[model samples]
Target: MIYKTDMKRWLDLVLSIIGLLLFLPIILIIMILIKLDSQGPVYFKQRRIGKNKKEFYILKFRTMRIDTPHDIPTNLLLNPDKYITRVGRFLRKSSLDEFPQIINILKGEMSIVGPRPALWNQYDLLEERDKYGANEVTPGLTGWAQINGRDELPIDVKAKLDGEYVKNISFAFDFKVFFFTIAKVLTSNGVKEGRSHSKSL
Candidate 1:
């Protein structure tokens, strides 16, 4: 069992620390912008289901306004823009908002690459993840499903992809997914402007 995930956990730790250091300036700027663009804390914390179906708080830069929607996923909201802040859109598109989750990874609540954790209340997706055995592994910053179709993929499809990742977990596979994630972020591919399109990081 450890063969599948221990290496990944170490990698997640080292890389997340290094990445946080490298992106310190960028993170600071985003923090300032998020504060200036809206009224809220710099970081948004919400409960998510992690490895072994444990509930843990996932961290991200506050993208939505403070007035409403505490724990709801961005995609679930009918009027996502109503809650989304101005700077949030760009951050989401760039995938920079996810920088805060590096903290989660460092805390051992997440990995650098694995199935993205489901929201605490996403009962159906949680059930699907459990069925696929995806819940046995720590959720990650990016994963196989994210690079494949992202928001375009259905829950069942995403679960299957996560299952594939769990079965094939390795350095090479993680490297590939990491590269593809970067490419997608740069190109803004699979990023949704509306809440109905897909989930956010």
Candidate 2:
């Protein structure tokens, strides 16, 4: 565990710094579009659990319209498109909306490869995650579940994949996920579930 701790911290610092240097301009463009598309803040910050069960605010580009109902599930299940802005849908599809999370990674709140963070109402899923060993590492920007099925997969399936990633964490696997992530975003595969944001999991 100490190895993972030290390794992840070092990688997080190096990758985040590099990510920021490479993606800052993209972040700025997204921010400008977000402001043009909605009345809310350019960046959306949400609380997510991190390593050691600590909480940190995850930053993302604003992809939803202002006054979007709070009832919307953050997980993207049921009605993914209902709350998304005109530009937001494209951003989500391209996975560009998540570029800002590099900031989260830089801040030590996330990793480049790990389980996607769970939301507050996702307590039941969190319980399942804990049982499956998904909570063993810091959450990430992209991971096995994401590269495999993304928002299309059920919580149980994603949880299992997440746990698998934890048990088998390795640089090779991380590289695979990273490149696969690029492929997923390019094809726009599994960006949403059927007609909804995600299938409620």
Candidate 3:
């Protein structure tokens, strides 16, 4: 039998391409806005761990000033607001910052649904996820942890949710996640409300 995991790979490719094309105009607009709103790259890339503990650069829209400290998790930052650009704040709030990860999906570094990638330096989250076997599958644009509580969830809780997602992988489950993501994005709901944890990729 063709496993759903294989099916999910093809699904990621198809949907990511389609989504890229559909959002191209909006992406361009956002790029221009970011450029005008800040003095830095429109896109940001950071090293993140993918399946099997492989490291890959995750792409995102740059939502922070050029001098923002890199490698530290947002929630650990002492003063996140000092680095967030005006446009970056909006992108983070709308979850539009995540759109650039379509490139990661196309590169097979990620899926549309799975555990969200942890930064390469995020050993705490990385270790927790590894313990739960969440790092065995491709990371995602959004996942069970994202839908459940996002940044509000503790590291261990996030890993548990990710593990649960892996166990429940299916076309139906993915569809369910897709719809919930749309709803969250539209309502700007479930996202952490503080800029303290909204720095960059």
Regions of candidate 3 where Cα sits further than 4 Å from its true position? 1-3, 193-201
For model 3, residues 43-78, the per-residue Cα lDDT tens digits are 998889999999999999998888977777666767
- Which candidate number maximizes TM-score? 1
Assess every candidate by TM-score. 0.94, 0.87, 0.92
Question: Higher-lDDT candidate among 1 and 3?
Answer: 1
Candidate 2: which stretches are off by over 4 Å?
1-3, 74-82, 193-201
lDDT of 2 at 198: 49
Q: Please count the clashing residue pairs in each candidate, in the order shown.
A: 0, 4, 0
RMSD of each: 1.6, 2.5, 1.9
Cα lDDT computed for each candidate against the true fold: 0.84, 0.76, 0.83
What lDDT tens digits, residue by residue, belong to model 2 across residues 1-201? 654768767877888888788888877777888888778888877777776667777777777776665534645335546677888877777778787788788777788888988765577668778976787688899889988888777778888888899888877778889899889778877765335444222
Better of 1 and 2 by TM-score: 1
Per-residue CA lDDT of model 1 for 1-201, tens digit only, reads 464646677778788889999999999999999989988799988889999999999888887888856677666678787777889878887788899998899999988889999888888888888887999988999999999888877889989999999989888888999999889888877767456554454
The model with the greatest lDDT is: 1
Model 3 misses residue 200 by how many Å?
A: 9.3
lDDT: worst 10-residue window of model 2: 192-201
